[model samples]
Target: MHILLVGAGLSGAVIARKLAEAGHRATVIDGRDHIAGNCHTERDPETGVMVHRYGPHIFHTDDEEVWDYVQGFMRFMPYKNRVKTTSQGAVYSLPVNLHTINQFYGRTMRPDEARAFIEEQADTSIEEPQTFEEQALRFVGPDLYEAFFKGYTEKQWGCSPTELPASILKRLPLRFNYDDNYFSHRFQGMPEHGYTEMVSRILDHPGIEVHLQTWFDPAAAGEYDHVFYSGALDGYFGYALGRLGYRTLDFKRFTYDGDYQGCAVMNYGDRQVPYTRITEHKHFSPWETHEKSTCYEEYSRACTPEDEPFYPIRLVDEKALLADYIARAEETEGVTFVGRLGTYRYLDMDRTIREALDTVAAYLSDTAQGRAPRAFYQPPMG
Candidate 1:
């Protein structure tokens, strides 16, 4: 079977490798010049720092299968994401941990004391929270909400926290202890060689052919037995329904001498700050030593046709439009949608790989039983 795998990100690379290993010819194409998509990483020519072109991506997954699978491609160095944030002329730890609570209040409170204090500060009047603002008020109370989340969420999403869903804040933890690690996953690390090289190795299979800087032409779909699309769901159908809402990032890159900020990610939680966060690229790979460092001041805004879409804003209006696109995808033949952009969701690296593997298994099973593959492994509506 000749398979067309669009978008050479993790989704495309994993699926292409699986199909190629099963003796099927897989042609992988990406609009970008690189293979890793948003996870693309390259070394700075001057600074010698491994730069994450599209912000920082720390690989953290609790799934043992997904963790072991990535290890097959590249050596992953032990990395923990300890994020710092600045608010009102002060720097504190992120995720609203005990240390942050103690530092912000200038009091040495233990875990139990901090928990009780936060609960007391919380608004007991609101029984069930619907919006992000209400969720924050209910969980961490007004002070912490304004100091840590309010401004940052506004800048990141380009909207008031009151307008956003409570589910968004629900994912963020309000730690009782002093543990400042951003993620609670067992496996957390970054590729030693960089994400692009890791993905390049994934695509380096005998039966797989890679075509970078190539755009998918709908007319070309007929030439292949099946098409695995990881591109935008609306883009596949030429945005016939309407463009889905997305929040894109704009990066202001700069080079520095020695260390800058002394941390990997420094977030600005104040609305006065124009950019949301600053990432020091060299800090991402602590194993490698370098005198110079490269960093990016990231700003989030509404996505346009010319900009690269980063985060999907699946509000009520966008959901209705997405339903129309999903209907069209179901009616279409020889194409299966996969990955974040395809399904219109914010997915981590592990979730993307796990779904890709599942997609391959389903495809093989369907072909063996003489049945057509489903349009999606996970439904878009969910």
Candidate 2:
């Protein structure tokens, strides 16, 4: 079988490798000049630091199989995402942990004491929270919400908390203990070489042919037996329905002679600050050291047609438009949507790889049974 992969990112690379191993010829194409998509990394010629070109991508996953799969391609160095935020003229730990609570209030309280004290501050009157603001007020009270989440959320999403859904805040951890690690996953690390090199190795199979800076026309789908698209879902249809909402980031790069914030990521929680967060790239690869450091001041805004989409904004209006696009995708044939952009959802790297592997397995199984594979492995909507 000849398979056409639309994007050369993690999803397309994983799927292409798996299919190539099964003795199928795979051709991978990407509009961008790079192969790794948003996770592309390169060395800073001046600083000799491994820079995450898109942003800081920390690989964290509890799935043992996924962790081992990545290790087969490149060595992973142990890394933990300890994050901090600047708010109200003071720096504090993230996720509103016990230490953050004590520091923000200027009081030393044990876990139990802090828990009880926060309960008193919470607005119990709202039994069920519907919006982001209501969820924060119900969980951590008004002061913490204003200090940590309000301004940051507003800037990141370009909307007031009252307009966003409560589910947005549900995934965040509000720890009673002092552990400040952002993610709770068991396996967390960085690829020793870089994401581009890791993905380059993944696509090294003899059966796979990669063409960079290639624009795949939908009319060319008939050239291959099957098409696996990792590009934008709406883009596959030429946005005939409507463009889905997304939040794209603008990274302003700056170089510092010494360590800037003494951490990997420093988020500014005050809305007065134009940018949302500043990331020190050298800190991402702590095993390697250099006298000079490179950083990015990240700014988020509504995505336009010319900008590269980052975070999907699945608000009510966008959901309605997405439903129309999904219907159009189902009506179309011979092409299967895969990855975050294809499904129009925000997904971590581990989940993207897992889904790609599962998608290929299902595709192969269906072909063996003489049945057409599904348009989607799983519904995009949860």
Candidate 3:
């Protein structure tokens, strides 16, 4: 069967490659001049540092199969995300670990002692937290929440913490140990050559034809046997209902002669700072020594049609709008919505690749059984 993939990002590349290996032809198209979507990376002409065109993306996942699958493409260097936050004119380790807790309170409490101390500070009265602010206060107390999460969260999402759902805060880790690794995933690393190189390798298949600067019109879906669209859900429908909310990022690029922040990511937890974090690209590839460094001061705001959408803002109103889009997608035939944007959710790289692989697998199975492919592997909302 001849399949059309709408985006040349991780999802499109992974799906196209898998479909091609399964003896099906896939034509991949992207609106951008380059492939790899937001994960696109290139060497700075002056600094000679690998720059993440969008933002820093560290590959970390517990899925062994997904990890092995990526290894088949490019080599991954050992990299752990030890994120630090600048709050109230001081630098502290992220995830509010034992080190941060001790330093913040001026008490070198042990693991158990720190755990007890945080518990004492927690608002035990709030049996069930509803908002991001409530979750933080209940778990880490007001002081840590205000100093670390409050300002940053407000700046990142462009809203008050109280307006955000509690589930967003649940993803964050509050540890009593000194382990400062940003993610608790078993495997954490970055592509040695960069994500763009890795994704390009994934799309290199005899059965696949890639077309850059090409936009696939939804009306042209009839030309192919099936369409695996990784573009925005509302976009496919021409935004007949409404545009789903998204928080887009603007990167302010700068060059530093020496080591910038001594870390890959240094988040500013003060709302007054404006930008969310500063990412030093050279630190992303620690093995490669470069005298110069390239950094991005990332600013997040409400996404407009002109901006590149990064984070999906699935607040109450957006969720309602998303439901309308999802319904429309379900009614549409011969097209499957896949990936973060298509599904209207914020997905990690590992989840995106894994879902793409599974989507193709399900398509093959459905075809074998003479069944229609599903519009979505899972619901957009939980």
Candidate 4:
């Protein structure tokens, strides 16, 4: 079957590659001039170093399949992400670990001592924590909450932590040990040459044809046997159910000599700082040493129609709209919505590739049995 894949991101590119390998013709179209959408990387002409055009994407995943799948294209150097956060004129390690606790309060404590101390600090009155602030206070106490999360959370979400869900803070683990490794993943690294080359290698198939700088017309799906849409889900439906909420990023780039931040990602966990985090590109590639480095001070805001959407703000109201759009999509024909934008959720590249692989495998399984392909393929969750 002939497949029309919209967007040249990881999900679409992986699916297209899989489809072409199964002897299906796939025509990939992206509105952008280059491929590797959000993870787009290119060599800086002046500095001769690889630059992540969007923002720093540290590839960290525990899934061995996802890890091995990515490595098939390009080499990845082992890079542990140890993020430092600054707040209230003090710098601390991330994940609210033992070192962070001891340094902030100016007292040394063992693992058991730290655990007991935090438990005592926790607000016992708040039995059922709902908001982010309440949750943080209940777990990490008032002083740490005010310094680390309160202002930073408010800045990132553009709202007080009281209005936000507790689940946001729950995602971040509070460690007992002094393990500064941000992620507890088995495989963690960035591409040796950068993300662009890896993605380009993925699409290097005889049956695959990639058309960049082209807007995909869903109305012209009749021209092809099937469509794999990875654009905005609401946009695909012409916003008949109203636009879904999304938070997009604005990056301010600057070049610096030698190391700027000491680490790849540094979170400014203070309201005084306009942006949430600063990314130093040179730190991402630990294997290659460069004199000059690039940094991006990232600012997040409500996504406009014209802005490049980074994360879906799937609030209560937006989730309802997404439900409606998803229902509409199920009723529609000849299209499969995959990946972050298409599904209207914030997905790391690993999960995106994993899901895309699942979609292609399901389609191929149906073909093997001589059955009709399903309308969509993705694991819907609560």
Candidate 5:
């Protein structure tokens, strides 16, 4: 089998490696001159720091198989992500923990009391909360919502909380305890080398051929027996239905004398500020040291055709558009959509790779008994 993989990100790289190991001729291509798509990392010539070009990509996953599978390419260093926030001319621990709750309200409440007090504080009205604002108010009340969530949500999503769905705030936890480890994932760490090096090693097999700065063509892909596309799902159809909505980021970087915030990430939760967060790239790879540091102020806006899409909006309007695209994709042939952009969902790096590997396994299983490859491998939500 000859496998053609579009997009040299984790999904493309991992799936290509798997296909090649199965004695298939796999060809991988990307628009960028690098291997890892959004997780691209390179050495800063000036500071000698490993820079995460897209943003701070902390490799965190609870899946033991994913953790062990990724370790084959490069050594990983154990790193915990401690995030802070700047709001109301003051700093606070992120994920809205106990200290933040107490300081914000000027009350000394223990873990259990805090949990109980927050329940008391939450609005009892609006039995079924639909919007983000109503959901937050119902969960943690107005003061805490305004101080921590309102500005940040507005800035990050470019919409008032009322317009957004309650499901958006559901994953963002409000903890009673002081544990500030951002993710509850069991395995969290960074590659000893940068992501580019790791991915480069992953795709450096004899049977694999990598083509950089290549554009997609369905006619061109016909040369291969099977196609695995990790590009935009809507893009595969040439946006015949319409462009599914997406949010993209523009990064502004600055080189400072020393450590800037003493933390890797800081979210500027103020609608007054145009950008959402500032990431210190040097801090992401704490295993290495540099006298100077580089940080990126991230600004998010509607994704343009020219820019790389970072996040899918996945609002009602976008979902409607995506439905039409999925139908068009099902009618098409020889291509399977896999990964975050392919499925039109916001996915972490680990999740994307895991899905890609699973997709290949599903395809191979179907082939062993002699069945045609499906247009997609992901199960639709009921």
Candidate 6:
């Protein structure tokens, strides 16, 4: 079988490798020059520090299979993401932990006391919270929300919290304990050689041919037995219906003599701050020693056609447009949609890999059973 894998990100690389290993000829194409997509990383020529080109992507996953799978490609150094935030004039730990709660209120309350205090501050009247604002108010109350989330949410999403979904804030944990680890996953680490090299290893099979800096022509899909698309769903259809909303990021990079922020990620909770967070690339790989550091001040805004789409803003209008695209995709033959852009969802690295693995398994299984594979392994509509 000749398989066409579009977008050389994790989704494409993983599926391509799987197909190639199964004795299928796989051709992988990416619009970008690199292989890792948003997770692309490179060593700075000046500082010799491994810099995450898009942003810091800490590989944290609870799935043992996915963790062990990535380890097969590259050595992963154990890394914990301890994020810091600046609000008003003071600095504090993220996820609104016990220490943050105590410091913000100017009291050394224990876990139980702090929990009770937050409950008292919370608006119990709101039974079922609908939006991000209501969810925060119900969970952490106004004072904590204003200090930690309000300004930061506005800057990050470019909209009022009231307009955003409650699921967004639900993902963020508010702990009464002092544990500041951002993710509560069993496996948390980063590739020692950076993501680009790791992905290169995944696509190293002889049956796989990689075409970088190449645009995939949809008309050429007939040449292959199957097409796995990880590109934007609307883009596959030439945006006939309308462009789905997305939030893109811009990085203002600068090199520092020594430690710049002293942390991997620092969030600016005050709306006065233009950029949402500043990432010191050196800090991401703490095991590596470097005299100088490279950092990026990240700014998030509405994605333009020219800009790279980062986060999909699944507003009501966008969802409607996405449904139309999904319908069209279902009717289209010989192509299966995969990954974040294809599904129009904000997915973590683990979810992306897990889906890709499952997609390939399904494809192989269907072929063995002499049945046609579906357009999507995981449907976009939940």
Runs of candidate 2 exceeding 4 Å displacement: none
Per-model lDDT: 0.94, 0.95, 0.93, 0.88, 0.87, 0.94
- Model 5: weakest 10-residue lDDT segment is 373-382
Q: After superposition, which runs of candidate 4 have C-alpha atoms over 4 Å from their true positions? A: 379-381
lDDT per residue (tens digit) for residues 111-206 in model 1: 999999999999989899999999999999999899989999999999999899999999988898989999999999999999999999999999
What's the C-alpha lDDT at position 367 in model 1?
A: 92
Q: Write the per-residue lDDT of candidate 5 for residues 57-82, one digit (tens) a residue.
A: 89999888889889988889989998
Clashing pairs in 4: none
Which segments of model 5 are wrong by more than 4 Å?
380-382
Q: What TM-scores do the predictions have?
A: 0.99, 0.99, 0.99, 0.97, 0.97, 0.99
| Residue-wise C-alpha lDDT for candidate 2, range 1-382, written one tens digit per residue | 9999999999999999999999999999999999998999999898898999999899999999999999999999999999999999999998789999999999999999999999999999989999999999999999999999999999999999999999999999998899999999999999999999999999999999999999989999999999999999999999998899999999999999999899999999999999999999999998998999999999999999999999999999999999999988888788999999999999999999999999999999999999987778857886
Compute the lDDT for candidate 2: 0.95
Judging by TM-score, tell me the better candidate of 3 and 4. 3
- Candidate 1 whole-model C-alpha lDDT, 0 to 1: 0.94
Name the better of 3 and 5 by TM-score.
Answer: 3
Better of 5 and 6 by lDDT: 6
For model 1, the superposed segments whose C-alpha errors exceed 4 Å read none
Model 3, span 196-296: residue lDDT tens: 99999999999999999998788999999999999999999998997999999999999988998999999999889999999999999998999999999
Instruction: Mark the 10 consecutive residues where model 2 has the least summed lDDT.
Output: 373-382
Using alpha carbons, what is the TM-score of model 2?
A: 0.99
Model 1: pairs clashing at backbone N, Cα or C within 3 Å: none
lDDT tens digits by residue: candidate 6, 172-280: 9999999999999999999999999999999999999999999988999999999999999999999999899999999999999999988999999999999999999
